[model samples]
Target: MEADYQPVSRTDAECLWASVRERASDPHAGIFGPSSISWKVNRESALFLGAGRAALLQLAHPWVAAALDQHSNLRNDPLARFHNTFRVVFTMIFGTLEQALAASRYLYQIHTRIQGAIPETVATYPKDSRYEANEANALLWVYATLVESALVAYECVLPPLSPGEREAYYSESKTLAALFGIPSHVLPATWLNFEAYSRGTIESAGLGVNDLSREMAHRVLQSKGTWVPVPGWYRALTTAWLPERLQEEFGLAFCRRERDAAAGARLWLPRIYGRLPATVRFTGPYLEAMSRVSGRGVGALTRTSNRFWMGQPRMMFAERGLGDAVELPQPLQ
Candidate 1:
């Protein structure tokens, strides 16, 4: 809500650019400090906001402001997309919208979470060092990106809003909806798909919590290291059809008991999936392979974006001495 936005100092910007690029690899060694994730977000705020903060004051809604304010996490820790939506929003307001969009590109690997509805996209490190972005995480990322981008695009088309307006200070749309616990459903029925998967999970597992409860519906959005917690259940269920040796390794009983017992389950993972073949260590779980092969999985990463540079922005943003200057940053984000 304040007009204090500005690009970060060059040194700060450089540091944050590195941190965000290294998000998956940042260590929890504490050397990076306790607030590394928030640090990157703030630095990005400065980088993207630059001198555009005041000019963009008319653009920020309340939820955007809050997201910029509340980015606390280690750089490598995984966070819910909804939890970290503001940093991307602010970057675009400042004309450096590239960062926001690019971060989404970096997350292409996580195409579906919560059955392609809830995305756990804004994953920071440390907390997520043990977790990999899985189906639910991917879904969360796309869902959040679509909602945020659409909301901003909406603002771009409407008459410019003014300050001192109540909606100007707070998000009346998506973020506000999420805050009241009535908001996340504003999404299309892809959300219903998420609900069905969750319900099926609970029922098949003999879980009795209402399908709509936060616990049952969103639990698959969690993880440990590179493994997705929700899909472990899928694997466990299907493990019954696996050879007995695989069943022993997959340990269907432990996975079921862990989630049913209300534990974070990462701590109990040895009982859940510690016995699986190491081939899955590099490749994710077998269920994901099924999703990929069956056409329900996240899409593979592609390098075609590099081709965008040859397009016209090169001429528009180019300088003569620099030679052809159209550029898109590396997709690694």
Candidate 2:
């Protein structure tokens, strides 16, 4: 919260929206430096989504209305008005295609109570922040991405947008990129593609803050622009550095519970050994990259990855350099 926030500062909104546009690549900090997107505030932002349609009703921003409208019109078809925006800006990073579609339906479902938690959650952010602004397209796309992801993860479904429909989705997001003064080359060719899609939402690509998470959403809502503990909270899990509430809200604890399951050896192996070695801090770029993936891939011709979605797993032969390299004596100890 800004110290002098007046709830509706014409000047402040101007400055904030300007900063939001300016910090598109890295809006995790305040207008200047040092001030950041407090992870605590992010939980507040998620509260907004958790609040449901009532908050959506209270949310009067043109873009929010537009997204609502877009979602409504696309409910029957699911891809007509929202294909590319959903895919490139959102659908890829978080939830599955099925989850995205359910969120689509929920956002537009008629006469139903939109729920208390989501609306209450949404109320936490200062409405004037960039997340609700008309000019910041990245905020819009990423918000849609997150809302859809959270809904999908909770609902779990299949949102396969066909080839033709997919192209239309791509087209809409591209138009958004240009309208917001973002470079065309910056937009991702595919969702979660990171290469192209990351461009649509960056304040600075070189800084390495990509993907949507509660932390980034807080930045957008607060218009502060800092990248909080989003991309890799697991490292925080190892260090016990994250707030308990944020961790719980995002379900970090549930993942650890996997270790105790009877036959879930597949998930346990990666947690104990495939990941989290002793050679260095648990936070590594590789770990961060791996975090974005949901589900699994085959580890080789032989086995699986930490998650269970089943794509293709990557396999590497054991190496002999670097001081027993992360020598932790394996989980057998």
Candidate 3:
């Protein structure tokens, strides 16, 4: 653990309420309107758990696993990486279009430097076959994973969406994918297609979990160098949320006590979370965006950002791109 890393405290959150209260309902600031299912679902705090689930799904993809193994220092600096990723995600969902575009550009710049041949081939994909970050298939899988996990977490922690709302959420997610430079053709046209695509990928031999993916999943679940000490219940819930096929492939283990605890959390946590005050439940990106539209200084709101949230970092990491110093950890053999 980094001695210098400070966990976000309750005091930090106390300071944020004033800013949230003063936030404006800016109609033109964000891509997803307040009425959109994307905004309603993405605003919740439970997505922090969803992010872990999504990362595992992405890592399980052979191409994504190779890319991250070769390029990311996530194992060495999990908190920093997670913070950077979360900032990008929440910004796309809640930041103004300009901010979302900026975050997307930053991501694209990073991905541009991430091209390389797979270290090991699987099924049809041979080793030494090159993969680029902008590749449509890989990008689509990554985007789909996040969107799917967000919905999973949303339904778990909030009221279940109506059938029509579910479709709207999927449709709105395409806009999010577009912001990240994913081509329209790559995205599934509907919620049904997305579900089928995700299932095919998960069950496909071509995307089976590898050593690299398993190691990364272990690190996330174990909370190694994690910003906050992940609770046992949280770990249990996230593991339970993972696809059963993946659990077996990744060798995730849980005892009876843990399973029982997870079952309890699955039953009660969402209800409790849904009951939280709006100021407490909504994410910082949402609040900051509202501040911008409401004519309040976003700086004040940002001070309390990334602090006091279960999923947020105690200390924020600086956003980085291609030229930034990245200390890639030793690749999983």
Task: Name the best candidate (by TM-score).
Answer: 3
Q: Candidate 2 residues 243-331, lDDT tens each?
A: 24433432334355432341243234335443433222121211212332322332232122211111112111123352212211100
So what's the TM-score on candidate 2?
0.22
Off by over 4 Å in 1: 1-11, 15-260, 263-268, 283-333
lDDT of each: 0.26, 0.27, 0.67
Per-candidate TM-scores read 0.19, 0.22, 0.80
Clashes of each: 31, 44, 0
Question: Cα miss at 320, model 1 (Å)?
Answer: 21
Give candidate 2 regions above 4 Å deviation.
1-155, 162-164, 172-195, 198-251, 256-333
Q: Model 3 over residues 213-265: C-alpha lDDT tens digits?
A: 79988888787866567788877787787788887788877668879988899
How well does model 3 score by local distance difference test? 0.67
Q: Locate the minimum summed-lDDT window of 10 residues in model 3.
A: 1-10
